[model samples]
Target chain A: MFELILTLVLLVIGFVFGQIAEKRHFRSIIQREAETRDLLCFNERRIPQDMFSPHVTLVCGSVVVSVDFFKHFVATLRNLVGGRVSAYESLLERARREAVLRMKAQALAQGATSVWNVRVETSSIHQGQRQGIGAVEVMAYGTALVPR
Target chain B: MIVTNIEYIPGKKITQHLGMVSGNTVRAKHVGRDLMAGLKNIVGGELKGYTELLTESREEAVRRMVAQAEAIGANAVLNVRFSTSSVAAGAAELFAYGTAVVAE
Candidate 1:
């Protein structure tokens, strides 16, 4: 019985570490931010922005999470459905955010100011349900536009 | 990431760009989620760096893009493109560009 308990504890610890490392990896990829020159400007229009802003996006191919989202989710879900949701949410959100950020980074590299009509789309790699070690993806994309 | 209402509308003069457009700090939760996705790339996982930044930057970009397009009296945007660059170590940029045209 003691051995079993110990093994369980080790498994949790390992998972936690993996989570931490994964977090670091995401941070590094999206380490860059918006620059003044990289800002897309369209000064002529009148329509305002809505949906989610000052927002961040990441797309893979499935689900995605942002730092704020994952943290809040982990805390809230932990209080509700325990931490089992951690692995699923963690992977999904992470991929989503990374994919979105990469799109932005690519835009910036192209000497564009901003990307418009931003969105993240998700698609499953394998058909059928995403159960038991199945890998899925969520893609984040938007128009890289220049301000008028 | 495909955005809605960004194309030229028959009655509307130009496409409406909607997304996150702000000059504020990105939260930790969002960043945390992004990191997890980055790690997945190791095993031929999808890289999602573009999605996050695009989503965040699109709002601002669209806001400006629309404003400019409107100013130019453009009714539509076509063949858009995205671009980015390094501002600071932890900061980057995302931009969208397209031909602002006056489509009936």
Candidate 2:
């Protein structure tokens, strides 16, 4: 009974705190995405020679995020039904977006007008002691072309 | 060395191709980081420790790949790619590959 109560309490606390953090992260991502609108990013292998810049360099950004206890708990419950695990969906989405934003920021810092051949790679760094996932890592990389 | 994911550099010419070069590293999570990550699972956010580990592993892999390219007397590495795989429960392997080339 005591262990049950502790688990419940932790779940409630995790839910409250996790919700706040997720909302804050989403807000920041949206704001930054808007600010980086002008930094062109693409997956094309080639950039038009006419618009090409002689100075080219590599840029990369990485983010590692984990799911809160409550979400993980809910996800486990959903797994019993064997359907989509929406809890993890948002976690990965945020990580991917954040990684891209950071890459764009790096390119901008290097005075690059655009990034080409952008690639995003994701991996699970930690699997939870429990059945759920513990942490995920997203890495975004690209070649930046700095104008003369 | 010049490393780009693109097959061809914008203005530079590829004078010679030195074939494919690769570097890989397998890294395991330390006990302290595993403990911290366990705690973070409660009210989670970013996992800084894991991020650092990945960054370091990637840099190491890239460095080794560049070393191989240099050994081949290549000035550039083009079409670079990275791959990651789980080697163990708490460990992962990061592999980088690219074609070494001479750009003039």
Best-performing candidate as measured by TM-score: 2
Tens-digit lDDT track of model 1 for B1-104: 22222443213343344332222222122555445544442232333553445455546665576666666565455545444443333243545566666543
What is the two-chain DockQ of model 1?
A: 0.06
Q: Show model 2 residue runs off by greater than 4 Å.
A: A128-133
- lDDT tens digits, residue span B1-104, model 2: 88888888888888999999999999988887877877788887888887787778888999999999999899999998888876666677889899999999
Candidate 2: the clashing residue pairs are none
Docking quality of model 2: it rates as medium
In candidate 1 chain A, where is summed lDDT lowest over 10 consecutive residues?
Answer: A54-63
Q: List model 1 lDDT by residue over A1-148, tens digit each.
A: 9988765655555456555767686676556433333454332222255322322221111223333323333444578756465645656666765666566666665555555556555543312422211344454555454332
For model 2 chain A, the run of ten residues with the poorest summed lDDT: A125-134
